[model samples]
Target: MKLYLQYFSMLVRCQMQYKFSFWMMVVGHFFMSFSLFFSIFFLFSRFGEVDGFTFPEILLCFAVVSMAFSSAECFARGFDVFPRLIKSGDLDRILLRPRSVIFQVLCSNIEFSRLGRFLQALLILIYAVLTSGFAWSFDKIIALFLMLTGGFVTFSALFILYAAFSFFTIDGLEFMNIFTDGAKEFGRYPFSVYGEGILKFLTFGIPLALFQYYPLLYLTGRSDRIGLIFLPLIGFLFLIPCYAFFRFGLRRYQSVGS
Candidate 1:
């Protein structure tokens, strides 16, 4: 833990060295996300609501997904850029280290600029919470926390799976973005808005909806089932399979020989 903090501090200092570039990146990312927020605003302007969810309710879902995704991108940036590490033979040195590979890889990169998106999402989350009209209760608060945590875990797992695939191709798969980046865009609305088929796929296949849609229903009082509040926890189980696959790939890894 101390080592991780040391790495974090070093990375922060290195990034802070370029104040203008760093703040530019931060502001660029914030406005990029704000554009999506505008898309939602315009959609609601015309239709008022979609699939029975009001603007604020959908905003809450957007904020949760954005916050979760941004957090993952911030912390799991190493996996997101795993191909670069492989290409540069950094993974070889990482493998020789006494530390856990996952831990070392995690410590390899930290993207503080993503905090802009996180901050925007948090503001939207606060706004949504205040206007959405749900009676705030203790359980709902817990459910919201779980949703954020579970979503972060789920996206991180996807990044790991992306990295694992790189062990085979030595290049990152673009289609994997369909899960990572794509999820962030699609997730602006509840998964149900996509269609029942996509919703089921997200639930049982990718488990995105495990941390997103079901818990949302409970949060909004659209459903009375207490089990829904806990569904996000199931998303944590997804890490097991993703990690197993990463290990399987590690065993077969051949260095890029760079």
Candidate 2:
């Protein structure tokens, strides 16, 4: 943990060297994500509900996904930018360290700029909690906390999976955004609101719903199934396969000419 902090501090110092650019990037990211908010707003303006979910419920879903995604991007940014690391032969340097390769990669970059998105998500979350009309109980509050943590883990795992895949291709992949960015956008509404088919896919396949939709049902008082409130923990399990795939890809990595 000390080493990680050291590296993180170094990265922060580097970012501070270009303070204006850093702040500009932060503002740019805020606007880039705010556009998504407008998209949601426009949709809700046209229609009172989408697939039975109200505007406020959809806003809550968006906040959860956005917060999770930004948190992943902030800390796990190295994995998100793994193609550059691989192409630049930085992975070789990381491999030589006595520390765990995954840990080092995770610490390679820290995007302070993503805090803008996180702030936006926090505002939306506050609004959601205020308007959702459910009385908060200890268990429900705990479940909400778990939902945030679990969502962060699940999204970070996806980013790591994307990084792992990069080792084979040794290049950035655009299609992977469908799972990351696309999920954040589409997830603004509960997976169930999409369709039974999409909800099943999210639950059994990617398990995005494990962190968002199912727990949300309990939080909203739509269901009293206490069991479902803990479903986000299942999302953490998704990391196992993602890590395994990354390790497998590492074995296949052919160092680029230095």
| Alpha-carbon local distance difference test for all models | 0.95, 0.89
Which candidate achieves the best TM-score against the true structure? 1
User: Which parts of model 2 are misplaced by more than 4 Å?
Assistant: none
Residue 45 C-alpha lDDT in model 1: 98
Residue by residue across 1-258, what tens digits does model 2's lDDT show? 898889989999999999999999888888888898889989989998887778888888889999998998899999999999999999999999898999999899989999989988988899988998778889989988888988999999999999998987888789988889889888888888678998898899888889999998888777989998889998889999999999999999899996
The parts of candidate 1 lying over 4 Å away from their true place are none
Candidate 1, residues 95-197, lDDT tens digits: the string is 9999999999999999999999999999999999999889999999999999999999999999999999999999999999999999999999999989999
Root-mean-square deviation per candidate: 0.8, 1.2
